[model samples]
Target: MTDQVNANSYLDTDSSNICEVLQILGAKWAFLVLNELLRGPQRFNQLQRNAAVIKTQSLTDTLRHLEQNGLVLREVFPTVPVTVEYSLTEKGSDFQTALKEMNKWVEKWGKPQQVNGKTSISS
Candidate 1:
């Protein structure tokens, strides 16, 4: 019989600290929301329409999570009707640079593959 071992057991270095940051950013719909806000501030409806992949409740939750993590800034205007807008904070801007770098890495080393019966790519 062959010995069973966990893949992570072979790695020598610990990345638990970095994993926490990744965990926050790696949530579903988080990156998409950030992408929408990258260009400029957007209203809730705009983001909802742009990210059709995300459910409204999930998007709202992701936005709150980003805001709590200092990656998004929510602004409220007191007019006849309330106007709420979301923008990337300075921290979020820095995170965008990191995302760009990640994109570059994927472009260089990733290849298209079939994942879960769906065409996808990985780096």
Candidate 2:
């Protein structure tokens, strides 16, 4: 085999790390949740309200998944009734650059169209 490595070698399907990251990010609300967390730490209720469309169970599941993946940090504070907040870990914050690039790409090429009353991109 040639010594030169393909630039996209890490994107191969067999790359477990890449696959895992994709799986985590491919979840329905992952992007939105990450976008929200990029701002700052937030409580469960705040995230739920900001996300607008996610159900309680779905948000919980998403947060748990993010936490399990080392992308989100969950902190519990001692208070009258106890308080919990979620924020991005270093690894998660590192993903911001990728998200910014993705935003750039969308702005460059995404064509918004009406699809069943929902806004979708046209190829």
Candidate 3:
């Protein structure tokens, strides 16, 4: 399959349109990381801890991908060992509102699916 890359993202350009926005949001781990950042900005380790089952490589890749896509911002602090934190950009924060609405909708009428013997999205 041909990798879509910017074909689906980047709405401000002539190459794409708003209709393709889902291609950006639907990226793997995109929404998950966005949801975590919705709580607040976090260091890489903190993000890893909060995301739980996500592997280090996966988190790193996702963060890099999000940053590249202009959805997440990465700030590097000047310190002894240096610290890096990730937070959502304005576009990303806007996307969080959508995810929150989806969560609310899911809670209201989403089907009950078995996940590890408990309901999916169960805490």
Candidate 4:
């Protein structure tokens, strides 16, 4: 008799780690907000302006989640009305290396093509 392979056999630790990371960054606004912060610290208004397409509420929620995950830091100044600024934590800054690698991978193997009004990546 021939041996059969299990379809689920490919699941492994690396896949689990990737899945967990995606869960944290997969939100519509999370990566966008993080990318903006990678430039440096900025006030809420500045982030909203630079991110352009993100709504005020969505930006607020994304910042809150990033802060909770220790990927961002929120600071408040003792100003008249209270000023706030957001910056990436060390953990967040470390992600820049990974981003660079992903960008390189895209350059090498991620040619985009239009298909029925949608875009798709093809090697």
- Best lDDT goes to which candidate? 2
Q: Go through the candidates in order and give each one's C-alpha lDDT.
A: 0.86, 0.89, 0.83, 0.87
Tens digits of lDDT, candidate 4, 1-123:
123234344456558889989877877898888889899999999999999999999899899988988889999999988999999999989888888888789877898999899987753
What's the ranking of the predictions by lDDT, best on top?
Answer: 2, 4, 1, 3
Q: Candidate 1 at 2: error in angstroms? A: 34
Report the error of model 1 at residue 98, Å.
1.0
lDDT of 3 at 10: 50
lDDT, candidate 1, 1-123, per-residue tens:
133344454342247756777888977888889988998999999989988889999999999999999999999999878999999999987888878998998877789888999976685
Candidate 3: 10-residue stretch with minimal lDDT: 10-19
Show where candidate 1 strays beyond 4 Å: 1-14, 113-123
Candidate with top TM-score is 4
Tens-digit lDDT track for model 3 on 1-123? 234656544534644554467667656787889999999999999999999978999889888888888899999999989999899999888887777788898887788889888877432
For the record, the alpha-carbon RMSD of candidate 4 to the native fold, in angstroms, is: 5.1
In model 1, the clashing pairs are none
Number of clashes found in candidate 2? 0
TM-score of each: 0.77, 0.79, 0.72, 0.80
- lDDT accuracy of residue 51 in candidate 3: 93
TM-score of 1: 0.77
